[model samples]
Structure formats: structure tokens, C-alpha cells
Target: MTDMIERSNTPVRRRSPGDPPTVPNHPVGPGRLRVPLLMFGAVAVLVWIGIWIGNTQLTHDAFFPSRPGIAGGTWFEGWQRWDAYWYRTIVREGYVSYPGVQSSVAYWPSYPLLVRSVSWAFPSIFITGSMVTLACGAGAAVALRRWVGEFLPRSAAITTLALFLVYPFGYYLYGAVYADALFVAATIGAFLLVERDRPGWAGVVGIVATAARPAGMVVAVALLLRVIERRNLARAACSPDAAAPGPFARFDPRALRRRDTPVLLAFAGVGAWSTYLWVRFGDPLLFATVEENWGQGAGPATWFKVRVFEELRDKPLAAGTIGHVVQGLLLIGALALVPRIIRRFGWAYGLFTLGVVGLALVGTKDFQSGGRYLIGAFPCFAALAEPLVSRPPLRAVLLMLSLVALFAMAVAYGRGTYLA
Candidate 1:
């Protein structure tokens, strides 16, 4: 509650001249942006409607999280299946049964810890957490738009956000209170920091983001990128003799002195989180065992069982269902478009993509929706925008159709329906 409530309790008085802007307030300008802006607004409305629908239908009368063969407090409200339920327990009570039989359920902390802190300041932490999740998704979109804008023409940037809003899988972020929103925001924010040459900031965000669901593993790529960039510069400057030094090597120690900080940060971040895994339960290496005791092993047979059985083996119709099939296709389309986005920005965001792909693999089973598992790749919207509307009248027509599909998908997603 501290994290969410503290911000809300602070009244939104008009900013003082000395104050910094709270958010990306101010319209994205007028004419060329009008349609996209309208579409973004529609995205917001549909998300609210989705929450309303979920609150009305999904709130449990006595929703207890049942960890097999273990006895404890179970029921929470609103968030009951998949990661959310276990997370709620983690927030309420610290960490337990983690490294032993229930190891698979001991998540990375961070988000649940934030939830616990926020619950302290709120009347109903459940509702507050859900809203916080929603806000996180919206915030991520803004950060993503800013980062993408660096490469895209202004209109394309705005269009990128619009496309994200109406993406067939986009609705999942708001459909249930999941980590997808926070992960998206954090991963994109990390990219923005790296793009701005703030590797330190990028590293910190990566640590926190990955803590949410171990999805922040993608952020490590950003750190790796910094290391690679430094190596490239040093290699170009190195000479054949005299300790293999070159012109700048004899004088400037800028790239050489602390060339490995980013790499160390990467290890520190992953190691620190891995340490949390050990400290909380025991075996720092084993991420989650609760999911495993109930049969979440990563062996070929278990993997085959999940792939063949295809339904929610662990929980209800959460991530481990046919829902994942549709989501996978959506992810495929998103990945295919990444190269175009990198070209537009003249930057390589492969590390971010790597993290997304890695986390998707770690999911043990398919994730709930497109927005949940792979959408956090961050650059995909910008990439997707290109294939449809790169040029003129015909492209514009394609863009219009995409916009229609986008909004329609947003609405349909909110309604929780699927077309075969």
C-alpha cells in the first residue's frame, strides 16, 4: 500500500514552476495524431470496462489458494489463479516452503513486496493492487512510446501506441491483475534508460522488473549490450604492441578504467536475485518448486505433458491453456517485426528481445495471453506498425483497417471471448 497509496494520497495540485512534470500530460499534438490519440483513449476505456467486468465476475467469495498437501490461509480476493494467487500469499506472509517441496512457487519477490507495502496504506489492498497493475500497464505504454519515438517519425510513434492498444492480445494486461503490465513498463523503462546512456539506471530497473516474474531476465541483455559496446570501442582503439595499446589507450582511460561495470552489474543483479531465492527458501538456483512438487518439472516428459495435455494442469484457465496457443502466434508476429524497429531506430534491442524469449521459455507452460508473455519485448509495437503503414494511400487504408481491428480486439479482449 505504501507504494500505491503514497502516490494517490499526495493530492494532484497544479505543478509549481520548479516542479517536474508528473507524467506525459499534454496531448501528443493535434492533427496527424488525432486518430491515434482517439484510439489510445478507446484503449483506456476498454481496459476500465474489462476491470469492471472482472471485478463483477471474478471476485471470489472465499478464494483460497490451495498448495497441494499443505495447510494454511488460502483465500484472497480478485486474484486467485496462476502467479497472482501465490503472489498474494507471498505478500501476506513472507517466504516459506520455498526451497523444499514448494520451491517452484517462491517467486523473485519485488512486486509482491511492493504490494505488501502498498496494502499497509490502503483500505483494500486487493483493489489497490489491481488498480496499481492497471496503472503500471498504462505507464509502460507511455515509456514505450517515448523510447519508440526516438526512431519512428512522430506520427509513427503515436501510431505505435495506438496499435499496441488494439493489439488482439493487448487486452490481457487489464483482463486480470497480472504482472504483464509492470513487466512491460519496467522493461521499456530500462530500454529508455540505456538509450539515454544511463546504464546504471537500466541495470536497477532490470533487477526490479525481473523480480516481478523472473521476466526481467531480458534486461540482462541490456547490460550485456553495454559490455559489448565498451568492448567494441576498446578493440577499435587497441594497438599491436606495447601491451597492445593504441593512441587513446596511452592517454584516455575512459572506456578502459570501468569497462566491466555493466557486466558486473549484470552478475550482481542476477546473483542478488538468485541470492534472494536461496535466502527465502534455500536452493538459490531452483526458481520455483511449489509449481514443481505439483509437477512443474522442466524434464522432457513433463514438458511433453504440458504441451500435449494443453489445458490448465496447475490452475484454472490461466496461462496453461489453449489461451497460450493464440498468445504464441501473437508473439511470433511481434518478434518478426523487431528487425524493422531496430532499423528505424538504428539501435540493436536484441538483448531486450532475448530476455522476453528467455522468460517465455521459463514460463514452464504457456502464459495467459499475448500481452502477458511476449508483449513486454517493448519494441514490437513500433515494428508491427511498420509492416502495415510505411507509406501512403494504400498503406493508410491498411493502417485504418488495423486501427479498426485494434479497437475491436481491445473490446473483444475485455469481453473475454475468442475467435477460433
Candidate 2:
């Protein structure tokens, strides 16, 4: 009985420096990139099916229709909808405020800027944009694998990546017009840099991330946590005694200066962009404030608006509200896993996920895009994946359900029925 308990409680071992990496507990050679790439291909197939269904079955009356210039109208127009159309407009016309319409100022400039430059050489801006997202999304998967492997074994790391690919709302990444794929790539790369103990590079990558989306600013919490953890580790190592160290041993002024500078620089990158927004639009936070036009605002009031009797009493039980409810529950579940992430990963990763989710929840009218927003909180995926690593049957069921929901969401999004 004692031996069985001990065996059951034993932790899985990771590959040593000399040992070759494996895939899903099998010897698959040192280069384990093929499975993840294959995973991406599978997701692409699902997305294509969803888009095809929408293009054939749905009416375009209320849909944000794409113009005939792209590929001479051979391509399906279902992929261009909601915020995607705004990105296209911004790329072509630049930011301009229109009466009653959401301000183009609300959209960050980085993605549209990239789209404009890439369009110079490509046949179609939409095609070029899709290529950009695919490339960045692939990079993000690679970086995410490395980060997850730091704590989990290679097999678990792969599972986590798989989970991310099939995550119910992951279809957003496939939308070429959405900047989320690039944002994810930069954000994951920044985290990977911190894991490698390269603070300066982390901050450099984090700057690009910060420009990708407003939620990018929350990464500052992760950087700060990394700085404090590193300082603590340095002080503990330098101490003469293991148990009780002197005051001098508890703090290191030199290490603080060396490590904390990069974090400040990263934050300054975000500040510089905000300053640019202020100069151009007269409101540094117009990006945030513009959410009001969409009925979103800061604090609990935004969420409470949906609950008021007079507000939603006449509102029908439509597809949009249902999608929001589904996504909100998913986001809450992910948020609830932060404590487990802290225990399994570390302070920086867990706190980063927590801070990002909390910030996203605030000033949001309804949870319409909560899933896509939470997709930026990558650690939540890791935390959710950890327990299912060894539970093949359970993981399989979860993946099946996720894939089903992904299909539904993809169809809805393509049909313009679920704009969020």
C-alpha cells in the first residue's frame, strides 16, 4: 500500500540536457515541431469548413460585405466582418472619426500599419493579412511550447498547445484582419524571453505587444513580477546562511538597477504610443473611451447594464446574447484557475494571467468578446491543460466539445450573427 501510494505520487521527469526530446511520451526525435504544425493544419481545415458553410448558407444583407476588388471576387467574403472591416478601412483611409460610427481612433495603429506595408507587394491585402496572421500564429505556438515545457514535460507542453489551437473561440486567430494573432505572437515571445532570463529582450518584444492591443499594457505586471523574483533569488543566493540572513543579504541595490531598467523601458514604449494618440486625437485614452460608443465602460456598471430589468426586459433571446453568455462563463472559468497557475507555474505567469483577465473584465459592456480577449491570457490555457495531461479520455472529451463549439462559433462569426 505504501509503495503504491509513493509510486502514484511521484512526479513525471523532464528530459535532461543530454536526453533527446520526445512527443506525447513517445520517442519522436529532438525536433518535435511536426505535431504542432499538424495541429495548426487541422484547425485550418475546420476554419475553412466553417467559412464555406457561412458563404453558401448565410444571407449577406446585414453582413459586412467585402468589395469585388479582392482576388476579383473569387474568394469568399464571409471572413470580413465587424472589426475586420474597420481594420481594412483604417489601412486604406487611415484613422478618421465619423458621426455616430465607432471612431477609427479606437483601433490600434500597429496592425493596420503592417497591413499597409505588406499590401505594397501582395496581390490582395486580405491574402497578405492572412499570411501575416498564419506566420505570427505559428511563431506564437512555438514560443508557447517552450514556455509550457519549462514546468510541464514535453508531452504536456504539446497537449497545452493542442488545447490552445482548439480552444472554443480560437477561430478569431484565423481571421486575417484581426491583430490578435500578432499580439499573441509578441506576447508569448516576451514571456519566453523572461523565462530565458533575458530581461532586456523581453522588454523589447513587450513593446511591440503593448502596441498590438490595449490589454497589452497588462504585461507590465508580469515584467514587474519577474524583476522582483529575480532580485529575491539573487539575494537568497548571495546570503551566507540559508535559514537566517542579515538585512544586507536580504536586498541587493546593484541587482535592482541592472534588472529593473528593462521593465521601465517596456512600460515607456506603451506610454510613447499613448502620447502619440493624445497628440493625434486630443485624447490619449480615446482608444479606451471610444468603447462607450459600443455600450462598454469601466467597472461593474458595464456588466450590470445587462442585468437591469428595464434594459434587457424587451431584448429577445437571440444568438448574440447567447454567445456572450457562453463566452462569459468560459472566461470566468479560466479566471478561476489563476490560483492553480500560481501553484504550478510561478508568480510572474500566474499574476500576469490574473491581471490581464481582471483588466479585460473591467469597463466591458457585456462579455461579447471575452473569449477572444482571454485568449491573450495564455497562462490560463496552460493551467487548464496541466491536469488533463495524463487523463487521455478526459482530454479527448474536452477537445471534442471544444471542436464542436469552435465549429458553431466559426459559423456564427462568419454569418455575422455573432459579431463579438
Candidate 3:
């Protein structure tokens, strides 16, 4: 446990033979990248589907819609839910018109600001946000190619990026007037910066990301670690046998440690954000105010809005016990198994999964469709694909399918259809 925590906080250097690198309990550069390709392909198909369906849903009257203001849920219309409400509200009233809890616009200046800016130059939120995310998604793919050179080639990286762009979550998220699309791009871009050891730039990217979603705090934590490693580097630089003091003896072989700036920033971001939440809600760890507003302060975001009125509100958990811990726990289990699944995907990929799911576990476990909250962590796929799929041909196939799914999911999202 200590090792895991320390590993997470440390800024590790890119693998070098002399540096003695390690992968997820296995040899580095094992199988060729294949499985990731197919997964991405499937994702792509879903996205395309969402695009078609979402466009159609916009015109139908089967559902009523609310408008989301810049601050949160200040602009509630009768009957309609989240995504539709966001688009309508942003277009109709600008930032100040959000409804109830959803208005925590302070946490998301980037998306809202972008939408408003684009609205001035474009016709609709639908076009601007989608185009922005898609383009960012493409850039993320290119960055991913360079970042994952440890386990994948240019092709594998590109496939993973394409799949992430149209992921099922992107379909609904893109259509809705939210920051997810840009968030994905910023997060991935920051990770790529970390991979290159550009800590300051990475920090800025992380800051923008956090503003988009509280989960983005992970980037800040990773940055802090980088700051630490840079500051204490000299101590680590001490000669292996300088003094031979104790366990951390002046000269021991283990006295020195390599650094990765991004990992540290990710750690710091979470700490800072958590502290902020505490300050805002009079609690050290309160999440987005939106949950608190809906009275699901201690419930899952999904039906918790209803459940709080039915159960926990009067139970021991009371009004401030929010946490959709089940799925989050599952996401944790999946992350723990990540190293077992892939080679040396390391912090760039491994931690992305942990951070993404951890962020969702802490805050996103709410009134959202499956996979929506986790979409911003698109960087996780870039990292995870290396281990799950090997072999260029096989990885390509998987990515093709993931992209297809992305496309398909997009269509389904438009129609407000469900996937079995």
C-alpha cells in the first residue's frame, strides 16, 4: 500500500534501459498492440449511431426540456432532463440561466466559455462543442501516439484516439451543453505534456481541466508530485554509496528515483480540489455543489435525487453522505487489475484509469447514463490499450470496432435510445 501511494506521488522518468524500468509485473514490449484496436473500433460505431439519433431527438416533443444556467440548475424548465436542458439553456439564456444544482458553472468556465464564444461565431452549441471536442480528440490521438511509445506504435495510438472521440459518452455529452468534450481534449493534452516532462505547461492544462470537472483535480496532484521530485532531485542524486546510512542510506542502490512530472501534478490537483470543496460546503471533502443542491448530498447522482427523499435523508447517512461507491469500487478493481493486464503502461496509462474512475467514484456516481462520467478520462484508453491489445493487426481491428461503436453510440444518443 505504501509503495502504491509513493509510486503514485513520485514523478517517474520515461523508461530507459540504464534506469531499470518495470511494467505491470511483466516484461516490457510483450505482445503487439491488437485488442485495443478492436475495442476502439466498437466505440467508433457507437458514436456514429449517437450522432444520427441525437439530431433526431432534438426536434421531437416526446420529452420536455429545462435550461441550465452558468452557475448550476437555476434555469429549470418543466419535464426535460439534463443534456437537453443544457443545450436549450446555453443557447437561450447564456451562462447565467442554469437551473438548480447543475449550475456549478464555477467548476466549468472552459466549456461554458467556449460555447458562448462559439455561439457568437457559429450557429449552435451542437456544432461548436462537437467540432471542438472532435478536433481535440484528434489531437489527443496524435499526442497519444507519442506518449505511448513504450507499448504502442503510431497506428495503435491513432486508433485509440479515434475511438475515444466518439465514445458512447461523447454522444450524449457532446449534444448537451456541457464541458466534457473540451475536458477530454484538455486532460489528454495535459497527459501528453507530462509524458514529455513539461511540468509547467502540464500544470496549466490540468488547471483548465479541473475547472471543467472536479475530477480534473487528478492532474493537479500529478503536478504537485512533479514539483516534489524536482525539488528533492538532488537528494535522490546523491551517490549510491555516499554514506551508507540506513534503509534510505546515502549510497544504497535504491537511494535514487526517476521522476515523471505528470504523476505528481495529478496527485496535487486532487488534494487542492478536495480542500476547495471542503471550504465551499463547510466540509473538507464536499464534491460538486450540484449534488448538494439536489439533496443527494449523500446519495448517488442517479436516482439519489429521489432516494434521498425516500431513504437516507432520514437514515444515519443524512444529508451529506454522497458517494456512488459501488460502481466506483468496481472501477477500482478494474484499475488494480490494469497492471496485470498490460505491460509497463505506467502512470501515463495506469494512473489515468485510477484517477478517472476515482474521480467518478467520488463525484460522478449520479443521475447520468452509463459511461458518461468516465468519458473525460479518454487518456486512460490511450494508456490501457497498450496492455489489453498487442499485435498491430489485431489492435487495429479492435480500434476499428471501437470507432464504429463510437459512431453507433452517437446515433443512439440522438434518439435517446438504450443499448442492451
Candidate 4:
């Protein structure tokens, strides 16, 4: 379960003393890279097909009503929901608001800034956003495949990417207007670098990731914990007869000195954004506090009653009510698997996944965005997909559910529904 990289193409060559383990030795030849490239292409096609089908549907049953022609467009039509409009607004017009109060501060700046920076030459922000999102979605798949390949066989890694590509609510990542795709791409890339024993590069990628979404700050903790655990494991392996006190083993702090600097740099990503918010809005926590405006509170307890059971009690058969209840349950179910993930992968991965669930739990009304939030917790998906790797029938069943649900969710999203 806690296997390290050992691919045939990237054979684990013998290392000299005091040297960091080498990884990603797989050559970038056409024969080596073809599978991942094809996987990326396949994800793009599925995302495109979903958007195409969604464009033909009417927006009558949206989560919030939208006027005709407002959500329609030649490209990425109806993909712009409530939040997407705000992101576009931020990109087109810098963070200016009328009067004293504005909702624009609720969103972090990384994604809009990226859209503006990357699309400087393009006139249409929508086109730029869509292109960026699609590209990032493919990048995420490629990064995820590489990460999985570190532990699983090539065929298993490909199947894992395929599962993620069609994950029910995962289509949101491929949308032009949302930042989830970019966030996932950056996050997975950072972790993949960490797995390759490249913490400096991981930290660099993590900065962009943390700025993309507040939940992404957990990457720093993941890196820190991984470094500590890996060093301790190395020590234990080197000294099999070393005695430890009581039930716990001690880790040498000096072993982590080199790793800590880069991990701290990754953590600076959160601090940098907080500073930006404070300088711009006079409140570093403005983005977080704004969740109250959406009727969300800061804790798992806030979701247990009013967001779920109460809604069900008040409107037993209403679609929204049932949907909320189901999503809330799904959130709980995903979180329920964390212990297993930890036991299988190691404490670092377990703690990181726990942080993801914790972030998803707090600052929300319910598990409304649970599915989307869990997308950032890549380990959960990997753990879920682990057993099906060798079972063709089980994998097929999963594929069927994921594909059907993916198309259905994409249609819902296109119609401006709250799918996550």
C-alpha cells in the first residue's frame, strides 16, 4: 500500500550514500509517454461531449433562474453559473465594488489573475477561461497518472486516471469558469514532485496551488508530514535493533532541516494571499467571513441540522432537500474512508486527507459542495480505485456509474444547477 516508485522504464538504480532517491527516470520517448497523452486526450473528449450535450438543453430547471441569452454562448455555454460570473467580473474589471460592501472579496485572486495573465492576448475572457480550464483538466489527469504510476502498475495507473476523468461531479473541473481544474492540476503536480523527492519544486508548485483555493493550504502539512515519516522510516530501516521508549518511536528533528525550508515556502502561499486580502480589504479573513453571507457557518456542526435533517423534515420530498441530504451523506461516506487510506498509505497521506475533509467540513452550510471539495483529496479517489485495479467486472461497474452520473451532472451544471 505504501509502495514507492519502481517502474520498469524508471528502474531504481543503485544510489550512493547521502544521495536522495532518484525518480521519474522514465524517458520521455514516444513509446513511454503515449499512454498518458492518450489519457489526456480522452478526458478532453469526454469533457467536450458533456458541454456539447449541455448546450442543447433548456435552463428552465436551474438552481437559480437565469435569463435567456445570459448563459448561452457558442463556447462553454451555460457553464458559467453564479460563481463563474464573479470570476469573469474579477478578470474583466479589477476588484472594484459599489458602496462599502461587496461579494467579490469572497473569491481568492489566483484564478482570476491567472486568467487575465494567460489570456492577455485573447479578447474574450470566456474563451481564455475555457481554454485554461480544459488545459488544466488534462494537466491534472496527466499528473495524477504519473503519481499513481509511482505506486501501481502502468495499466492500473491508466485505469485510475480514467476513473477520475468521469467521476460523477468531477466534470466541474473541466469547465471554463471554475478554478477547480487549475487547483487540482497544481496540487497533483506539487505532490507528484514530492513523491519524486523534489521538495523544492513541490513547494514552488504548491504556492500556486494554495493561492488557487484556501483548502489547498493543506499541501504544506502533507509535505511536512511526508518528510518526517519518510525520514523516520529510513532510520528504522537502517537500525533494526534500535530500541525505542514505550510504544512510540522518536524521529530525529535534524533529518527534516533540509526539507523544512521548502515546505515552509509552500506554506507561505497562504500567508501571501492573507496579506493581499488585508492590504486590499483591511481584513485578512474577509474571504472566509463572507461565507456567512451565503448562510454558511464555520464548523461541521453547522451542517448537521439546518443544512440536512431540518431541510428533510421541512420538505421531505422536495428535490433540493433530498439532494442536500444525499450530498451530505456522500460527504460523510468519503470522510469515513480516511482511516483506511491512512492505514494503507501512511500517516502523512492520512493526515493530509483528513485536513481536506476538515476544510470541507468547516465554512459551509452543508455538504453542498462536498463532491467538488473531495476532488482535491486525491488520495481518497486512489484508495477507492485501488481494489478495482485487478477486478475487470468491478472496474466496469464503476465506469458505468461514473460515466452515466458524469453526463447527468454535466447537464445539470450546464442548466445552471448546483451540482456540487
- For all candidates in order, the CA lDDT equals 0.54, 0.70, 0.47, 0.70
Q: For model 1, how does the per-residue alpha-carbon lDDT over 1-420 read when each residue is reduced to its tens digit? A: 788988677544332211112342333556334544455556767555543344344432233322333221122232333455566677776676634466334466666666777776655545556656666766676676766655556666676776676555555444344566777777777666665556667767777676666655556655455434434334443422223222233223344335345533534555776787678557676664455674555676544445525454555465335556556566566566656643443234644565575545544454333345666776666766655555657656755675565445544333334321
| Candidate 3 C-alpha lDDT tens digits along 338-387 | 45322343333445466666655544333222266666555456555555
Segments of candidate 2 deviating more than 4 angstroms: 1-32, 65-69, 72-76, 98-101, 234-260, 303-316
The local lDDT score (0 to 100) that residue 208 gets in candidate 3 is 64
Worst 10 residues of 4 by lDDT: 243-252
| Residue lDDT tens for model 2, 1-420 | 999999787654432221112332332455556666677778877886796576557665365553555561423455666777778788888887654557887887667877888887766667666667777777777778776776677667878888898887787777546888888888888877776667788888888788878877887657756665556544554443443223233233455665557865567656877898788777788788777777775656785645433334555476556666666687788789987876665556677887777766664667667788887899888888878978999999998998888887777766666545
Residue 325 in candidate 2, Cα distance off native in Å: 1.4
TM-score ranking, best first: 4, 2, 1, 3
Model 1 scores what on Cα lDDT? 0.54
So what's the TM-score on candidate 3?
Answer: 0.60
By summed lDDT, the worst window of 10 consecutive residues in model 3 runs over: 71-80
Which one wins on TM-score?
A: 4
Candidate 4, residue 328: CA error in Å?
A: 1.9
Pitting candidate 3 against candidate 4, the one with the higher TM-score is 4
TM-score, per-candidate, Cα-based: 0.67, 0.84, 0.60, 0.86
Tell me the RMSD of model 4 versus the true structure.
6.1
